[model samples]
Target chain A: MNDSMSTRDSLALAELVELQDVSAVAFSGQRLKPGRGSNLQLSVAAGFALTEQALSYKFDLDGSLVDVDENDPLVQLSLSLVVTYVPRNANAENWVGGDHERLKAFGDSFAWPAAYPFVREGVTAILSRLGADAYQLPMLRPSDLL
Target chain B: MRSLYERVTATLKGARAVAAARLRHEVLALLHQAQLASRMTQSDVARELGVRRSAANQVFRGDGNIRTNTLAEYLHAMGFEADLRLVRAGEPRQAALEQRAVRPAFEDWRIRRPQPTTSGVFVTNEGDDRPVLVRWAATGRTESFRVEAEVTTLPAANSFTPLGKRMFTT
Candidate 1:
């Protein structure tokens, strides 16, 4: 993640940008039969998603209680959010250089932070509703992400 | 966010691909279930249908524009039939009841709709939230490849469970 912001994060953030929108691209949470494991398996995948107006970054967060049966995710939730940003001047989508690292960096600093609250709120509400085990999505500082 | 899926569905070619993909998706599911229920293999379906193993495999894999009659024939060979039904939309509970009470929606898809084909198929391996990228050229035909840092050729559907396959002309 350190190298992610090396060339683009500053530039993307430096330019006046609008967190133009945040929308749920996908959301599904189910509470299946009780499972054996108590652990929470969490996976977070981030990437750049092009928008009509600008370039956007999307984050997918999947959390499921640890279970012996892979099919049985006692309590599971998957959320995908796209955070679109309108950067000053250029069409954000056109500005991307197709560098994977740069796009990832842009997602980390710009997309993740803006989308984190919504993600956390979503996860909290679902798990709470399901009456599943209590756990918090860690609030990671920039350095903590490294 | 505009996914490769959105990009593919935005044009006429993409519209054809979407229709084809949807049909193919349903066909593959039926093929899998029917074969499993009958304890038959693709080769068996081929033998029953008097086609090459590859041809039978093609239909099973959703590789080509398989015809409605062909789907019925394939299912008949395996001791099943395609059933299409019309249901009215209603409340969530009503919809759930209708889903259980009526015949499957897609089984009839293979029995009713005309199939579509394109120059290429966008094969999606399991775990991709959206189509990140596609590499092409398979067995002298236009097939899909995946690139998420490394470029990996798509595997056979049997080997890898493709959650979805969206086909389109270049």
Candidate 2:
């Protein structure tokens, strides 16, 4: 949000150290709701924690669709993302739990926003692969996120 | 400390509920995307679905509890064949992302092998201009490599593993 720092500079400061999944969703027996083409119940969750050398974020994009007519239930589709960005700043470790304006700015303006596209991509790809081409990730204004 | 997932689950509770919450977010996101994709106005949806303009507005802005059929109607009005179905996931939220180095080509030099399975590789510098130093825990030996064009090559640093394309620094 500040003019003094560029996104590129913030990214260069926080190198992507580890990006992986912590929560693996099980969709072994997912099915459509009894009412065909019915409405879907969807959700998204975001949270973060500070590690020894990095800032970590987790995003879970989960959806549940039910067949109100069927006795059997459908499986929920959930994608839990875990991304760790290591701040190469020598003083980064010291700022772990303390109030650090620069760190907060880096996350809000650069690191956190940088992680949005992946979630969007996940939403679109999952829907497309499932043959639900009717939907896609919502449009985002550049200023809205950064 | 409890993991981020566990912590979230502790607060939110119920995988089914969490899944539903995410679905709603995607619904809103997709509705927004659809609205933008066709340049279709809220009035257009209201006209097509035979509803008041405010009704359509509430759904798009996520003003309150949105009906599933209402959302479906919005997409349908926009010429999209949207459906609500739960299918097996073929997607993966990528795992354990790490900084990696590209293989360096040198006649008398060797490249640093990225250990995707191994851990405890230490990077000892802050920026690009500074030389990167790596110290192995078992040997306690430090290896220095000058950073060249964003790629750092280690010559005979480990002397055992192949440095794949992924720069695995665990």
Candidate 3:
């Protein structure tokens, strides 16, 4: 993947992680589903990671938080991060196992900061330009996951 | 000697007409109070609701039968609360029947009836004989009209002769 596209996709994935965080927070306020073991999953299809990130920022502006538990059966943390990228410019048939391997490697690396506070702040800043709040994203630790 | 079927049918028809007339009067009384309190013309209300003036007039005149949701919306627009009360079926029937009977007499005596401001009308037009009497307060004019064809002629027409004279001469 091109360096610019990779950076864009990574940022987009980070934003989705942010929104899943906010939903967790709002749901937490209601105390409907409590405990840190709760998990929120976001599926990013392909070309709309930017759109999803923008949406996440919008939710943050509306005072939402995302919370997850360490012992969650699926992904664990005070947050979650998932990023999958399909080549937008390249022909699908031309791609090989090497591309998949690269994506998996990128997913692991990109997922970390994407699940953290800095990306959330960045999203908040973007949304603030549109007259919304810039909320602090909660910190997460790998040890918190089971 | 009336048949059982005829008695049942007449009772049902009477109940329906009474219900319908009561609804009409309730709606009119509400609109009348709203008009007096707010000093708002029918056109003003119509404009606010994005409806035609005639539609608003119909609402005030208690002419159109409206849906509950639409009535609710109108009530909301007018800053009124819609409350539902649960009462015994027999209680409502008795109260409604009494009100239905006494209302015309009150109007005939030129007495001011106690009417609260409300948004919607409740009507049940089941019965065959429905008598509706409307009196214009300003002109002291009284008009008695009935829904039934058999009872179309006015009852005690002479009782209103004074009111008729007062309305026509001046």
Candidate 4:
């Protein structure tokens, strides 16, 4: 990374277009079958693509809770997100094969740090609305995940 | 006190806001495509519209919200027309319909016509192969909710079908 490319600077130049599919579900007691509570699990997956203009990045994050007892379907929630990122002074015309992969790498490795807060806050807000106890999701860095 | 329905509505509105924010760029990209198609420069469009070069550039850069009339005029200058669409999730595109000046004043102009601030359209300039797609899904006890917005274009210089007219046919 160039000295000029810093997290602060990148975020300053990066413009977020949107976040979608922020949803959550909280389990109510008695809904969960005995022993089924031990199998509860959560998972996160993300994908990134360059916008048509090559001027931005669109990152999608999907998070869900699974393995809830059949009776406790309410205990699970699935979310889908669509995010657009525009990097200052980006040239999409020159982005081909290898360059495209590099850009996706950059999106996974850098853009997440900039966009995670919005995702985290959005998830927090929606879950709170559903009467779920306020929970803190683990903070993840691009290096840690990618 | 807000009911659960109201709370869900508020959260959905927030998601809509995010999608709307993204529309700024999508619109700009469409304008850029129009300019390219017409072989005009920013200066040319500005000069024709009698706006400053920076103002024109700003609109194309998605710097800020644009007025409906201003956007219409700008596209007209480029020989294109902007068609705002409110598409439902999983809806199939119907056969092209004839364009009508038939604006139901009460239902459209009075309550829901295009405005300076809210165009009520989301423009995704991606091509057919790799399209920029936005999808929202929310579940409830019995029913789920989903809707999409998109912008389509046609040549303004020629009388053509309006996208809103075609999709919004009640």
Provide the TM-score of chain A alone for each candidate, in the order shown.
0.74, 0.55, 0.26, 0.51
lDDT of 3 at A42: 28
Give the clashing residue pairs of candidate 1, or none.
none
Candidate 2 docking classification: incorrect
Q: Cα miss at B138, model 4 (Å)?
A: 35
What does candidate 4's lDDT look like per residue over A1-146, in tens digits?
55335443433333332222222212222222223222323344444444332223323333332243343433344343333432222343433232434444454555555556665665556445554554455677443443
What is each predicted model's overall lDDT from 0 to 1?
0.59, 0.49, 0.37, 0.46
- Scored against the native two-chain complex, candidate 2 gets a DockQ of 0.01
* Candidate 2: tens digits of C-alpha lDDT, residues B1-170: 87654555565455456555666887898898898998889999899889999988889888877886777778889877564444322111112123343222332224355333223232445554323323222322235433222222122112212111111000
Q: Score the docking of each candidate (DockQ).
A: 0.01, 0.01, 0.00, 0.01
Q: Count the backbone clashes (under 3 Å) in each candidate.
A: 0, 22, 13, 1
Model 2 misplacement above 4 A: A1-29, A34-41, A64-76, A90-97, A100-106, A142-146, B1-170
Residue-level lDDT of model 3, residues A1-146, one tens digit each, is 66567556545433333222211111111222333222233221111122211111111112222344343232111222222222222233433233332333234344333444543554344334433334444454442211
lDDT digits (tens) for residues A15-117 of candidate 2? 6333321222222224353333333445555455554543554445567544445434343455644444443443544534433444454555654455667
Q: On a 0 to 100 scale, what is the lDDT of residue B6 in model 4? A: 43
What tens digits encode model 1's per-residue C-alpha lDDT throughout A69-142? 46456887888766655444434455445455555555656667778888777777777677775556668577
TM-score of 3: 0.26
